[model samples]
Target: MGNSLSDGLTDAVRRFQWFYTCHVRVPHELVEHSALSLTEMRVLFAVMHGGACTAADISRTLGLDTGYLSRMLTQFERSGLIERRPCSGDARSTQVSLTAAGETGLSAASAHVRDDVSTTLDAMTPGERAQLIASMGYVQRLLSPPADAPQVRLRGPRPGDFGWIVEREAQLAPGGTHTQRERETRTAMVVADYLTAPDPLRNGCWIAEQDGVSVGASLLVDGSAGSARLAALFVEPGVRRSSIARRLIKACVAFATESGYGRVVCATDLNPVSVAPFLRPFGFEELSNQGEWEKHLKEPRAF
Candidate 1:
């Protein structure tokens, strides 16, 4: 049984490797036409994004041999694609940067690669695209070191995000008190209300993204005359306790304050214990034993 399971796992891994190499990698013909080999393009990308980069920096970032990378840099210089200068502080090292010509070349090459990739992605259904992105993120987290973890960013909702919000909220909803169907229905109502809101500037939704995949979400909409209701706040189980929830809440509250809301209130189905840690630090006071929490913001707290 052990051998059988091991063989199955190995086969799965092999299949994934084949699919990745065949389907995920940029086609060789495209790279050939871009005037930059794949490795050269990667080196250029490293230099483009790595401000004040040295030859050593590119080597370390791309895991290329120092001798090989130096040869590439020399070729790039000959082509007038990059400029290198001795570091002022450390004369032994050289600073590398893309010249205008280099930037133009790299941008053009990048555009071609992006267009090619986009064609493939455009063929996928919305759900398939989301799943593929989420799966890639999961694989990256499993394989990458902690220091290399992708930064979480907060952004306004995009197309198909509202549906995802409802689904995720329902899936992550605290169990035992409400059925999944009940939670889903409630979340759908909240999303619908936000969608039909009259004043777009007065209400907001923030989606927390890590590596371009949504992991958490929060909603702030009109409550009373001068209050905003914070609802549908949830984080993915895999990313909970990592300050994503806090960041989402901060964004919502900041938007609320900017929109001239006097206070922000949250009515959660979660018990107080589950919600307190996320709310109390933000000056939210429990308004009831049930899950009502509010924070009166006379001024925005420095986040």
Candidate 2:
């Protein structure tokens, strides 16, 4: 079963790559109409966007050999498509910029490519287009290296976010004694309680986002004796090591401290070896019970 599943996945990836290379990247009409090869068009795009950049800069951005890039620049210069000038700061380096003619050529080529892409997308229904865009984004995230991961932004929960939080928490629940339905039910209850909190100032929730997609979440709610309980802490598996969980926890702790909570406590069934490192940095000490952790907060100043 495992071998069959692996083979099927490999075949699917190969098929997608073939389709993308043939149809999605630079349509044949673009090459024929613009008379610019793919590499040339990419170099021109870099130059146009880079704005008075050095040859070294373009070479780094495009990952082209310096010698090959120099040859291309020389050809462009001869054709009056680009201008090169000695760098004011560094005599050894040259600054490159597109000429007016270069911009015009790039714009025409880009329009042709845009029209071709639009023609393909126009055939899909709105729902289909949205699904395609979301699937492509998922593929990009799955394939991109860790260094290329999108920036995570922490924000207060918005309409529809609570539902997302519950759904994701249930989906990513750590395996143990609990069943999936039980986890989902518990998450729904927690979200309901947060939404119905009596004092909004005493309770808080943060949603961690990457490129506007929710990737993690946490809640700081009133606990016994002026304390806050951190609950529903979860980060998507793909984005786990990127500090999304840390950011969510930090936000919760900060909010708890600012809201004048005496301390914050968290209960979890997560492995202590894994959970301790993250919690310890925030001054969270393990309680006598194995699955409990707490961090004492300094009292906020009175007005």
Candidate 3:
């Protein structure tokens, strides 16, 4: 069966793009004097977002082709919007920053965009605005960096993060043989259990947010006795294999240790799911079953 969710998400994105373009027309108006395109506006935003960036940095950040970025920079220089100076540390590269006129132009563009967004948001009811904001936040989180970055961070889940946790986990992790409906139902039950766990502190829930978006998440639950087990350790597909999972495992282990657990364990029916790849680096010992692993928190493990 076709997944309506994919179709819905695709249509929603198209609608949002149309809405944003229809309403946020003033940025183009502000830059009309320089004959800048929307693509050029994005280049300005890249430089503005990053205080001082080399051409390569801007190219990578904006996903602009080297040839296109070079042409754009040359045009921006002619329009007095930007200037490039030799990099102090790396003599081989040049750093680009906004000129006074460029700053003024950028400020005008930013102001117009802000005003348009604010006006649109203000027109909605409080509940509608909150829902819209939360939905946008969710979308941004799910589509963060293509791969995990070193700056990934772990923190306690906020008010509505459990919802996101469920959504991301269901989408990122394979559902095996369960029907779509059954998979969704089971996923919801698991999340509900996590939310209403008996011991909130002992059963820690953390989210890995990068660039102000949740990219990975993990949970620790009190096991059959005094021990605890790691559950729901997942990182988004785009930001995986970049040591994000390692950081997540460390966070869970730290929480379990602080909660007075003698050991932390993770059991799985699937062979080599997280064993050799993600967890073993943290010194987890395998059990006789070959499908379970445990890490005793005898002392603080240095990262």
Candidate 4:
């Protein structure tokens, strides 16, 4: 399977290379072209849109070799294609911008690719465009893994995300030989049922994905007569301190409140980490019982 995946990816890249190269790599195709190499045009484009960009910014965003970009900038400056000035705060580096000539060049280069893409897209049917976008999006996510802070966003369930929610929570329940697999399995089933049920009280079922990968989930289900329940809040252990769980709970509670629930309830395990100290900030108060927590709200919050 691994070898097949590798082969498939290689073939896909090979197939995409010709189209990208013909449009981007060959600058001579444009009537009023910059006559720049592919990488140079990319650098120019970066500068054209880069209002306050440094050399390092261009290199990082474009994934260009440092030495190569420096040489290109020097050549562009000599040709009066771009204006470079030392940064005010950091004299060690320089900021870049496209001069009038550079803007004309960027316009030409952009037009060449833009028209080609428009024509190709216009020729394709809607279904074909969707498939192509999905495929290209897959490739884009694969190539550009998250580099900055891992952003965890809560979105309603897409296809197969419910399964991810189940799988991710199941893998985290085991500790040692005395693992409580049965309890975790039951919990997953209950959550899955709640996810698919068509009750209006079911406020929302949100899955949290970190950098395009599902890492956590939370469910807001019908709890009591006039309240909502926050259920199945979990984040992968490897990604714990990222505040994904907090965001998920917050989003779920907001939805419940906005959906006209007077109060929200949650059940936690008998541990400080689970219920006692963990949910203090979101205005949850521990009940007189063992592991039950509740919050009362006057106004519903918008998600």
Q: All candidates' TM-scores?
A: 0.59, 0.78, 0.71, 0.57
Candidate 2, residues 109-212, lDDT tens digits: the string is 77867887899999999879866875676676666655455687898888778887777767776675466557788878877888888877788988887765
**Between the candidate structures 1 and 4, which one is better when assessed by lDDT?**
1
Query: Compared with the true structure, what per-residue lDDT tens digits does model 1 show for residues 1-303?
Result: 469889998899899888977875654644866867888888888899997799987987778999999999999999999999999989899999999999998777667768878999999998899788888887776555554455788898998899988887777776754677788998899888888888767789998987777878888888776888986788776554448878888898888888777799888664456767988888899876666888897743332
lDDT of 3 by residue, 49-154 (tens): 8978999999888788999899889999898999999999789898999999999977866775577678888889987986776567667655655543345678
How many clashes in candidate 2?
0
Instruction: Give me the candidate number with maximum TM-score.
Output: 2
In terms of TM-score, which candidate is stronger, 3 or 4?
3
Cand. 2 Cα-lDDT: 0.80
Clashing pairs in 1: none
Q: Quick one: ranking by lDDT, best first?
A: 1, 2, 3, 4
Model 3 Cα shift for residue 283 (angstroms)? 3.6
Ten-residue segment with the worst summed lDDT in candidate 1? 141-150
Question: Total clashing residue pairs per candidate?
Answer: 0, 0, 1, 0
- Tell me the whole-model lDDT of each prediction, alpha carbons only: 0.81, 0.80, 0.74, 0.71
Instruction: Please report the TM-score between candidate 1 and the true structure.
Output: 0.59
lDDT of the structure predicted as candidate 4: 0.71
